[model samples]
Target: MMSQYKSVFKDETKLDINYVPYKLPHRDRELRLLTEFFSFILHAPGKMAQRIVIAGDVGSGKTVLSQRFGMNATREAEKRGINLHYVHVNCREYRGSLFLILYHAVSVFHPSFPKRGYSAEELLQILLQVLDEQDAYVILTLDEFESLIEREGTEAVYKLTRLQETRVNKPQRLSLICVMRNLKILEKLDASTRSTLQSNVIHLEKYSKRQLVDILSDRVSLAFKPLTVPEDTVSLIADIASSEGGNARFGIELLWRAGKYADADDLNVVTPECVRKAASSIYAVMRKSEAAYLSLHEKLFLLGIARFFKESERAYASLAEAEQAYAVVCEEFNVKPRSHTQLWKYLRTLSAVGFVKTEVSENIGSRGRSTIIYLPRISAHELEKELTALLEKDV
Candidate 1:
């Protein structure tokens, strides 16, 4: 029998690094821009690193660009004999504790990394001491920076900003690249501090379809056999990414998934149709980070609804079936199942978070209507995987 996808599946468990681009697209422009911006700090005699903020919607390619800039900064610093201790950390992952982040910062530049028995303040002192001794400028890039305020409030944020205000007979020489997923990062800062951040705002816009197409096409050469990926693969991936709100990560992921499907079916050629089949699952998981923070009971409730609809194949699932399925998941997780009213409220929360769609439909015989919960896409397995990963991190 002829199979649809046979050739591309060398290893299903292959790491995703193969798909991630090492260098950013049109990255030289950003590198030059940031170089010029950092020049303001690097040239500032011992105390003038102005605050810079990077703003973009989720998946708009901010972090990747920032890292590329970070890499360039290190290269330039070395060329000019400028001492710089570069550190990159994602705040969302580190939002639970300021110490975890500082630990990461100290650990990056120091061989020992001071793993045992240091308070956050102690770690900061050690980091600054290293900086003073080395006469090094610090270029720290903090991604998902808004999470700091959301999770721990403003004490850390204000304190860190204060560090930038220090002067050795000049301005605070430390530079920071702060990334936020939303504009509210502006509101979180005081007026004087926001003014410093405003001077260096770099907005990473969503990728255009052509941009995503080019990205996927370029990677295809490195990732797959020549002429193996059909032309429509680019458009298929681009359309899905754009329709899902211009998510570059989503585009990269869909291409990865389509390759798998093609390989599994023993097809030598990757086609748009394969990507079409794979994108639903990709979209499902792309939004799971938002779901991860929901209460476990809420997750079980959503899981129950997802299982029911997945089994039923209809958009609208009966509350009765959903409740039963939910109960099963709660028992498996060893958590108490909530009542129907509480479950419905959970459904509303999920909808608000864009996990599921909901509608009201009348029963065949009953006078009143029941709430019908619908999956945002055909399957939410990816979503489940995302939430599970996030929960696992907390555990």
Candidate 2:
């Protein structure tokens, strides 16, 4: 039985979601900006604290980008005789507790550090004192920082941003890279914290299909055996992920799942069928459950959006276009179409539930402003099929 087992993965760990590649394709500019922004720590350590915000949507490479930069920056600092440490704290895991966040950072160096009995401020001071005695510095990355603000409110932001104020006349020992899905969360912060953070912000846009292809290709080379994954399979995965806001994570997940399917089936190579199976397994159930809650008009409205994408083969469609398609769908269903106001309400509701994404476009020629809609996680073609089957059953 052991001899019959066939595997295609050269190093499975390479496909791990948390694994940060040494080279990040299509993120050179962002990485360069990070290097420049934090260069102060290497050139003049302990002179001043640094803080920057990294904003991007899900799967926009925020966490990996920061980790990559931190890894490289620490190595460079070490070469220059600076003892710089990199600490990445996921705010979601700590539930945005200020004390817990600080404790985690300290525990990285002092594993025996007590977990309780210290206020946030006191923990912060202790952390700083430890760093001072060791003559070390840290580049602290707060991932999912919005969680911190949501749970602890603006006070958490204020405390982290104003760390330098606590140790006046001493060398700054901590710099911060706050990562969030988007900077809109900053609106809840106090003016001082917002202004300080807003001054240096790095925005990472979603990866394009070609970019995702390159990324997946790189991972495949390291994760799978030679010639096991063909170009067609990689392209299919990229195509599927591109429909979902060009999410690289989704693309990578598909690739990994495809490989797993190949291995489980004792196949020598990963095929397009494996990718399809992977995609369906990942989101089909969730999508169905979510769509099941929609009312009839809501389903019809979503079906219209899906049909618009199917017909236009475009990434985005105008609100007017979607409404027009929706009207057609309503006619086909033998139901009266909702007014424009009601359709707008449907759009909002669908967007809130993650069925569709919308943005206001200003450059619509004669149309001053128009709402642009696109599917975020599911492919339009697949969504169309799903909604159509459900609508027919309802009828």
Candidate 3:
């Protein structure tokens, strides 16, 4: 088994979602902005910490940049003898309720805090008490914070931001860096909470193709052996990522997957074709839990769409074409086909999860309207293969 295993990756974790590079490229301005905003913490230790919102699209480096600043702040505070600690939380993970969020945060300071038998208010008191005793400053970086606000309401956000103003002996101890995909979520917050965070929002723009190439080149050198990745292969992955909305994470994943493909085929160097293969199977990036939740007919519908697009060699196909192909797929597998309306519903579901792209075509149709559909990130052939394997496992 050991002899059979082969991989070009020197350290695969570099491709991980949690990996933070030592040096962040194309983000100097954002980092400088964060440093400037938080500079008061170092200049005046007891002064209230800044509350800021960081908004950006997925894979735009929001989490990593904020995290790097948090790390730097911790070190700088220690050098200045400031009683400061940085706690990072992904609100999506700790989002059972507001009580759960406070429990996790307070537990950082009070390790013995009970995991149960506490109300949200009680947990808040415990957290405040611990903060009062420690008399330390904290910068809480809440990532995917929109989920928390959406699920539990903005009560927690308002309380944390108002920590200083709410008390007579407020330690000026807490500040917030709430990371979100967009400020549009702010619409859901209480007007006061919305107004409080309105002034200090940092927006991270998506990376351009050239920036993505540079980002991937940096990771490739760090992740693979010298000469294992050719320069053109980097460009190919960058092009694919650019087409998919300039997500650097997608580009990095393509490079990692391409290398894995090369190694699996016993190739010496990653090639453009390997990148294409990687790009053709990008839906493999979907979380298994999400995939598991897909209904069997939904999966079959996707496989039909995949097979049609694979055969057509086009980025898109008509609904009529998809329906006809889907019926053929149903016949082949001895699976009963759903109505056209049901297939349309399945297409909508697939689109919601980023699996399929659907749009109204300008060309006139027999029915006077037609929707064109295609897989967004992967080729139909690859999707067919993946869906076939997935459905087989389900069986």
Candidate 4:
């Protein structure tokens, strides 16, 4: 069986979620605009850095472009003998508290900083003091920033934007780069903060089908050996991504998945069928962050649904059976199950997020009387593992 597998991936890590390609295709305009806007930080030290907002839809290249700007800014700062740093933090992971976000930002420079027992103000002061003492310039980027604003309110944004006013003896200069899905979150902030960010905003549009194809082609060259991923397969993945809102992340993920499918069949080249199979689970894997945020009972409920489908002969499972299965799972895991009404709410939540599909039974006799539930995009086994990992980690 080991010999039966023939892999096509040259470097699998190239397709990883954290991987940023050396060359970002179809994103030059955005990168160039950011560089021009942020030139002040590179040229002058101690000058008030610009607070720029990067707005875009999911997988629209905002994160990568901001990272590229950071890389170039670092290099340019070094050449000019400027003490500058760029720290990127995802707000979703630290959205629960403003202090946690500040701790993450400050810890980038001071690795010895304690993880707990510091107030939000204290963290900000520590960060300000360190940067002022070093005479340094820092650009702190918050990705998925809307999550932070929504969870912790705009106090964090207010303080950061008004950093110059809050400083005492030595003025501390800190810039902020906020990468969000859209400007809707800005409305939640105070009028003053909103006006400050309204000055510099870069919007990234979703990629067209052709643009996605170009972007995937670049990644394919880096991720797979030549000819391993055929042009037709790439086109198929592009079409899939385009249909799913031109999300380049989804496009590349499909490419990687298709490659794995081909390898599992001992094939040297990825095909359209492999692409389709890969897409079947894209939503599940892509929503890992959302899964991680689910409550314990909710995760168990999802796992129960997955197991029901995996064990049953049919592609779908009734809510009645799923609720019973969930009760069994809760017993095995030593968790008390929630009420049936609560479980239904969880089902609705999952369906809202595209994790599962809930529809009335279409059978002749039972039609419109009962609802059937099924995993819409991801496989049962894959979801089980994902939920298991999330549950085990919280333990």
Against the reference, the lDDT scores of all candidates come to: 0.68, 0.87, 0.80, 0.81
lDDT of 2 by residue, 1-395 (tens): 56766688999899898999999999999999999999889899999888999999888899999999999999999899999999999999999888888899999889998777879988888989999999999999999999899998988789888988867899999999999998899999999999999999999998887898999999999999999998877876876788778888888988999899888878898876566557767875445878878999999999998888767645577898999999999999999998999999999999999777677768745857778776655656677888898999886
lDDT of 3: 0.80
| Highest-lDDT candidate | 2
How do the residues 1-395 of candidate 1 rate in per-residue lDDT, one tens digit apiece?
A: 96443466343333253233566674456657777877755555365664678887766778777776777677767777877766778888886467887778777668777578977767766777777777777888877887766775566666566674444453354568888877676677777666656777887777776787777776676667677777656665675677677877777777788887777666777655456457665544444456767887777777777666545533356678778988987786777778878987887888887666666666888698887665544344554555456545543
lDDT of 3 by residue, 117-141 (tens): 9688777777777887987777888
In candidate 1, clashing pairs total 8
How much is the lDDT of residue 327 in candidate 4? 93
**Model 1: pairs clashing at backbone N, Cα or C within 3 Å:** 5-265, 5-266, 5-267, 6-265, 6-266, 6-267, 47-171, 285-383
Residue pairs with backbone atoms closer than 3 Å in model 2 (clashes): none
In candidate 3, residue 86 scores what lDDT?
84
Q: How close is candidate 2 to the true structure, as a TM-score?
A: 0.74
lDDT of 4 by residue, 227-256 (tens): 988776786677667767889988888788
List ranges where model 3 is wrong by over 4 Å: 1-6, 284-395
